[model samples]
Target chain A: MPDDSLSRMSLIEISGAIARREVSSMEVVRNNLEQLEEQGESLNCVARLFPEEALADAELADQELSSGNSRGPLHGVPLTHKDMFYRKGKISACGSKICEKYLPSVTATALLKLDQAGALDIGRLNMVEFAYGLTGHNEITGDVQNPLSLNHIPGGSSSGPAAAVGAFLSYGSLGSDTGGSIRFPASCCGLVGIKPTYGRVSRFGAMPLSFSLDHIGPLTRTVTDCALLTQIISGADTNDPTSLNHKKTDYLENIDSGINGIKIGIPATYFDEKVHPEVLREINKSRDVFRSLGANIVEIDLPDNFEVCNSMANIITASEGSSAHAKWLKEKPEDYGSQTRERLMSGLFFSSVDYLDALKLRNVILQEFLQDVFSKVDILHAPVVPIPVPTLAESDIQSNPGFIEYLMLLGHCTRPFDYLGLPAITVPAGQTDNGLPTGFQLVTPPLEEALLFQAARAYEKENSWFFPVLNDN
Target chain B: MSNQWSDFIERNIDVPEVKSALKSAKNHSDIKQNYICLVPFEAEPSGFSKVISTWKLKQEQTEDQNA
Candidate 1:
């Protein structure tokens, strides 16, 4: 295969090429590394590159594939991970200066599972400091530039992962979502991201921002790739007490089952309120395609406290993050970015009562929301962000005084699901008038990722929703 | 004047020293009243669910017409 072809191939396409022995894994890895060198500097997505280790793994995978010992779809796939996931002997700075040299002795369960499935890890991607902020600016790691527009923020926490995938430097990547970390960047970068049910994917060895709400999932070029990645990493792990015991289901098998008769809920109030006109138009267009797909569309209203979920997320994340970094904050206060340090320090102001109140309120809010929305529809659909991808300078923490408010607005649509522990996927819907990408989210009940994938794929097929830019290579 | 309550107050609000002083005040009710005001109460539940269900049914019917 041509070097450019291998470098630009999707994970699904790469698997087929490898399966047919048309290309060696080493060839693919080398192409990816070459692409990284050529295109990566502009994107600034990769924090570290492990070309030697990655090539070695690719050679081993090529040998296994030739010997009829293929490890499945991810086998020989070159991928990277968000910096928050620990990789033994590698720095997991989490885009923070405090742990710049820290390396965990163990690897994240998601990484281990992907490795076992034969995916080659090439590097660690940049992210928001300590995964606390959402606009993807990190003082310690420098800002990750969006591949599509150098000036626009990549939508972050999973900023580097999304940018890398969008730039085609890697086939797929693992990104954690505490409150829209995965979905925000994916939507901003015009990629697919799934934040699986809390505890559905084990969090063992992944850095924690909030133990109760953090979820690790995938960001990939296609919905099916996200489903495939989710399948390999999901299910119970003894190491993670919160991991679910639910039987793993085939996420990809039923993706094309069609959304005929599937009920899709559009929250009448939240979905329509505070939305940018362009974003709303794109969401409506996606809904039109769903209508053509024979799906039932319903307008459901979210519960009363849905808006408060962001505040709830802030209180819990701050309190827990403060506790987690209390030692670091006292000893290494100057090590953090101004915004990140301020955000972390604000946690100290949340009383224990306030933290516990937020936790209790979270349950109440989730229960009320599920009761109101889930009972009426199979899945909920909404615009992932109120506005299109903002310019990087617009989201700069230092320059933008209202950055926190704007970030909260972007997270507004997503954080509620995180608090509810539901499965949600963001798929490319269409583009704005200015030509930047826009996406809509599909959300399902906790542990119901298969349904979410099915709904997403159904909509994906009904419209030419996949970004043409992804094929620009 | 310093106590467990004082530490909790100091960490949560900016007035650590003042709050410590206030903790020893004979008229503690006024401070308690001020603190309670900051707590957010649940808003009156909106009947959004009912509106949503009706809207959903209407949307489905509309899609059916377009199909």
Candidate 2:
């Protein structure tokens, strides 16, 4: 196979090819490392490149596969993760200057799982400083450029993962989403991003930005690839107390099964208003595609408390984030970036009562969403961002005060899921007028990732939505 | 009326943009007035597996298969 073909093959395809000896593992890993060095510099997506380590690992993988010993399903597939996931005896900067030299003695459970599954670790991707900001601007490590257009932000916190995967620099990438980190970037760069139900995946080695809202998941080119990656990383871990205790089940069991009679809900009110006309039109087109696939699209009425839910989510995030950084905020305040420092400091002003009140209201609002929304529909469809992918200057909330509103507006549809701890996935629907990609989000009940994948697969197949390959412009 | 909130922001947070963002997030939500609902004894906080018992996607799928 050609290097370009091998570089862009799905994890499923790569795994099959390696198992059949059609393409050696070394070929796959070497192609990605070369692409990472050549293209990653200009994209500003690579935080650190590990060419020698990766090549040696790939040679080992090729030997193991040739010896008739398959490590796991993802055998010989090359993958990368956000800079925050710790690999033992290595530095995990967490995209901050204070942690520039901070090395963790323990490897994250997700990394261990992927390693056991025979995934080749490429290099750490860049991210927002401490995964706080939604837009892909990292003042310390530099911005992660959009694979589609260098001018726009590659929706952030997981900026590197989205850009790398979108540009075919890696087969798949893991990203952490506190707010809209994963989904926003996936939408911006046209990829499949899944924020698994809170606790569905373990956060053992991943750094916490907001203890209550932080989630770890994958960004891939296709829905089935997302399912495979999620299956590998999810399950209970003792290191993460918040990890859910559940039996392991195959996430890709019915992934290819079409959503023949699935009930997909479209919100009547909260998702429609204030949305850019082009974005809304594309989302409606996705709904039409689902309808044509023999699925029923119903207009579901959500509660009038979205603003309250968003506010409560912000309160909890600020409080928990502030608590997480209390030590560094007090000791090494000067080491922090101005944007992250300011955001963390804002948490100090919120009272414990405010935090607790928001926590309690979280139950009320969740019950409301469950009873009023999820009870009637299997999945709720909404827009990831109300507008098309914005330029770096347009979504720059730090310098532009007007863009501050975009912060809430960008996360308007996604933050509620984080607050509710539900599963949500973003599928690339189509591109906008300016040629940037647009994504439609489908949210499912907790632990129903299988249904989400099945529905998204149906959409992808019906629309024939192939992942767009980024060219050398 | 304004005690340590103003004092803390003035002393610790120096950036005008940071101060403004913080104040906006703090003052805008009004959680105390609107969202603070009295909890019933049977209900747990949302973060504490509040509605997991009611949502059984897996169970329902199994039942449908058996049927």
Candidate 3:
């Protein structure tokens, strides 16, 4: 197979091809490394490259396969992760100057699980400073360019993972979402991403932005690839007490299960008011696609006053995030990028009572949202962003009060889900008038990830991701 | 320290800590606190994961009953 062709294959496809000996592991690794060094520069998606290390691992993987020993499902398949996931003693900068040389004592459990599943770690991708920002603008490490158009924002915090997978530097990646980080970036890059149920995946070693809302999951070009990665890394972990204790659902097994009777909910009031007509146009098309797929589309009015969840979520996030960085904010105030430092500082403004109210309200709102929406349909679908993908220059929220509206608009569509602690997935729906790709988000009842994947797969079969055309362009 | 000070920061306006504080404070005011039953007596704060697990259990039992 051609080098780029090998790189373009989905994670599961690459795994199967490597197992079949059609393309050697070394060939796949080498191609990606070349792509990372040559064409990957303009995108600024990579923070560091482990060329020699990756190649040696790939060679070893090939030898093991040649000896008739398969490591596991992802055997020899290359993957990348957000820098926040530590591999003990390595520099997991997390797009912050404060941790430019900081080394972690323990490796993230998610990384350990991926290693056991036989994925080759290629490099750490760029992200917003400490995974705090929304537009992937890291003053510390430079911006991660959108794969579709380098000029547009690669929705961020999980900026690097989305860009890397979208650019074919890695077949898939692990990204953590606190408030729309994973879903936003993946949607911007026109890939599928899931912010699994809050406790569905382990957060044992990943850096904490907001403990209550943090979730780790996958981003990939195809829905099945996302499903496979989510499966391998999910399960109870002794190290993270909060990790879900439920039996793992084999996401890939019934992934192809037709959504024949699935009732998908479309918002009637909230999102329509916030979204641009062109962006709404794309999401409406996805709704129509679901309708044509023999699935029912029900109109859902967001549970009354549930919009307060967004503000309440903000209180919790600022309170928790401030606590996480309190020491750093005091000592190394100059170390943080202005944007990240200030975002952390906002947490100081929320009192303990405010934090408690947000926490208590979270349960009340979540129980209400589930009963109100899920009783009507199996899932809820909405636009990821109010407008088409914005250019990097316009989204510069650092001290430019003018661009603050862009930041608010982006968060309005995402923050509520984190507050509700439900599982949300974003899949490329179509492109907007500016020729930039836009995605629609589908939210499911807690622990209903399989249904989310099944529904997304049904959509994927009809409207494939928008990244392939980026290569042709 | 103040909402204006924090809001002056790059992204705080999006988070709007002051708005959240005031809204939550009003809901927690003494008058309504007595009447409104703020939370369930036995409920823990941020037991979202437990809620999800309970939800999953209910789903499974319902499926079994139908079968």
Most accurate candidate by DockQ: 2
How large is the C-alpha RMSD of every model relative to the true structure? 7.2, 3.2, 4.5
Specify the CAPRI tier of model 1.
incorrect
Per-residue alpha-carbon lDDT of candidate 3 for residues A280-390, written as tens digits (9 for 90 to 100): 888999999999999998888887657676566666776799899988887887888776765666577666766776787677767878788887899999888778889
Model 3 TM-score relative to the real fold:
0.92
lDDT of 3 by residue, B1-67 (tens): 4543344444544454334433333433332233225566666684766677787799899999999
Write candidate 2's Cα lDDT for B1-67 as tens digits.
Answer: 6754576566647667566667766674565466455445555454446465346655567689999
Clashing pairs in 2: none
Off by over 4 Å in 2: A399-403, A466-473, B1-7, B10-18, B28-32, B38-47, B57-66
lDDT of each: 0.78, 0.83, 0.82
The value of fnat for model 1 is: 0.00
Q: On a 0 to 100 scale, what is the lDDT of residue A89 in model 2?
A: 76
Q: Which order, best to worst by lDDT?
A: 2, 3, 1
Which regions of candidate 3 are displaced past 4 Å?
A402-405, A465-473, B1-43
Across residues A1-473, which tens digit of lDDT does each residue of candidate 2 receive? 23788887777888888888898888888788888888999899988877788889888888988889999988887788899999987788988898998789888899999998988887899999999888899778888899889999899889999999989887899999888889989999999999998888999889988878889999999888899899999999998888887676688888778888888999988778968999988999999999999888899999876657666777888789988998888789888877787777768778777887777777777777887887798899999977898898867667455444567788887888888888999999888899898899999887889899889887886764556332211
What's each prediction's TM-score? 0.87, 0.94, 0.92
User: Which has the better DockQ: candidate 1, or candidate 3?
Assistant: 3
Q: Could you say which candidate leads in lDDT?
A: 2
For model 1, the superposed segments whose C-alpha errors exceed 4 Å read: A399-401, A468-473, B1-67
Q: For residue A263, give model 2's deviation from the true position in Å.
A: 0.9
